[model samples]
Target: MACVVALLAAGCSAHATEAGPEITAGPDGVSISIPVQVTVGGMPAGDQVRVWARTYDRRGQLWESSGEFVTDGVGRVDVSTAPSTGGTYTGVDPHGLFWSMRLPENEQAPYPLMDADDVVVLLGVDRAGTTVARTTLRRVVREPAGQVLPIAEAGLVGDLYLPPGAGMWPGVLLLGGAEGGRPDPAYAALLASQGYVVFGLAYFGVPGLPTTLARIPLEYGLSAARWLAERPEVSGDRIGVVGTAKGAEYGLVLASTEPSRFAAVVAHVPSDLVWPGLGGPAGTQTSSWTRGGADVPFLRSLPARGASSAAPNQAIRSADAYERAVATASRWRLAVARIPVEQITAPVLFTSGDADGMWPSTAQAQRALETITEAGNPYGSALLDFPGAGHLVGGVPDLPTTRTAIPYGPVTIESGGDPATTAAAVRNTFSATVELLRKAMPRGRG
Candidate 1:
């Protein structure tokens, strides 16, 4: 069988002669933030065909997935919409192969990490244990039209993503969770591709910054926002903040304290109450945030009751600890630790997963929404809750989600949620986030 492969800027397509099967995938290359269409043809009707996907992460570790499906009456299968009869994932999910990818049993990495801006996936089709057709898909986190610039001045460390051919654009201060050391630019670049000036800031865990989350000043975020607003390409009046986990807590505090600076806020797996910082010495209490050189009141974390230690590989469910902490906190502590959502002027968007293992994000998010409603804030707020998703609900959509537990120091951390539900949550959360930002901080505004 003669096979021809054609590559395009966005993705690749392949075709085989009547003697063999054919595979087709398009736009040639695509943003990792979106889904791709994949179809296989020329197989015998009702015959089993195995479709496989493989990609090398930034660390050169291979991640792969495969599914077996019976062709339709027309001898074709649309992988995008077809239900996998048996494989790494079941049901019909357009991006199932991507999210269900897994590393080889011998591989040591906890999960596939796309450290680079893009990755190339090799997709193959096989029949009767023989390969028939193959193609390649290029997934990118950053589009060619976007540019990334590192920021180190003004006592700040971050990367700024500039949209293509920009007039004044809405600005977004992007913040990450406890992993710290400058947020990854992948999501910011994707946002930049959508015409926003995104600054991925790092408050700690990097040089010239705090080595840990303890006592990080809230003013630091304000300073970063001010710097972002002052950018010539940024519309000062249309600036917003997007943060996840601990960063979400920080963003909420910033939005509440300096309501005039931010027009929109997107918090993912957020905490309604401030929590203590990490990386401090044992038995020491330190606030994760501060303002005007004073530590902010924060809910203290309690020790895990050995429940999480029962999991294999010493993977701990951090949510249990958080739940205990909240349940046992003094009334004064609860009152003081709760974020003053009423003080926020911008419309807020909170996304949480009910099954999040890192913390009780769903309950906290609901509490925040209730507070917003009670405060009668002129700018309204919204929440997007996913039933079974985990703390990894935020970020560029359509990436691998198979690894719900990841290594954290000597032990593993259970993030909760299965791959399919988490993938769905991530996509929906991303859509809602973009919608909120566009509506609250419309472009072309001076």
Candidate 2:
């Protein structure tokens, strides 16, 4: 029951090696969002065992899980939950180290888990950390039971993944941030595996879409929502949106403006108020979005370059950007850019990283929480803030959490965050998001 996850160098004893272990996972195949039950059996009764797993991402970055747990009277352990005898967390925790593993950060290979079918090796050991048994699990890159259709009509360029069952499924509009190419299919596929019809939506940075994250019309998002609701395979009353970063800003606006169309929203690394266009230096600010040919008034963040002094807006790569953004709270709260949280009748789940270098996501989330409370929103709101985690907070948490100095368009932006904390944040947000969606959009499954 005293499970510890820190590095340890202990020896195994012969008495603790009576039988090897057998590991198994449920709901079929390695997937995300929905619960994947992992269980271990064939261990010595009334004893502890260490669980370990390793998987290499597409770019060859390694992700792992190492934790300790006690066996039941019949010699079994469920990795999805803490053992009754010992562990750092409790009560069906999906974010425990046993479930969501972490890998060391590699500056060279910052992206992980973007590819399909990454094989993961799971091992069970004794108290001394001696490898007693091992098995392999394939993280299914795509749901075999789902169908993906190309969506190019109505100026929307993306893929729509539908679960296999004939029953009307809850629909989710998934949006990525400014680093757009195609809406991430890996994330959308995983969500589809969990019985939801997910549309990997691309509003910009794709063929037939804008080349930059500038002056996007909010009606595009509204159209996507309406399209998702109209689909025969989707539950019209149970459609929602899942967005991160700039996409999160759009989601908040969409939920507020089209409250009746959405049942829930999950905004990962969200802002409390709309922000100005992402291109260019300070003073030459522009709107990031528009509606009906009019600009959606947005607040401005300090430019990363071209300022007389870099102290105010140069936090793009600063280690203390998270702290500084919160410190300057009074300045960013422009009444013109404030999103009407009260207007959103659907419940919202906001996830932020406290150490985010790109922007003040935590502070903005706090402002959102306050706004929701002040408005007395009947549907309510929730925030998941991770300390030491950086700007790369959303998407699937299974990806690498290394700092990437990649060129996002013409500018090179730093995606800051530590490996361990970012992994934890991903797990926390993913689980919470699924729960929020399920609660908000409850439809019968066939």
TM-score of each: 0.93, 0.73
Model 2, which residues run further than 4 Å from truth? 1-54, 59-107, 110-112, 116-134, 280-283, 305-333, 397-399, 402-418, 444-446
Tens digit per residue, CA lDDT, model 2, 1-446: 23232212222443343555777665555564444666778877877777666666567666665666778888888876654333323344444543345455332443324643434545445556577666665556576767889889977888899876678888999988877756667778777777798988888877788887888898998999888888888876558899988889889988988888889999998887877776445468678889898988876555444333533323236324334434565654577778887788888999998877677788888899889988886886888999988777776655545444445544445666765677677777877888888888877521
Highest TM-score scorer: 1
lDDT of 1: 0.85
Clash tally for model 1 = 5
Clash list (residue pairs), candidate 1:
10-28, 10-29, 11-28, 11-29, 12-28
* TM match of model 2 to true structure: 0.73
| lDDT digits (tens) for residues 100-137 of candidate 1 | 89887656553326653776889999999998999998
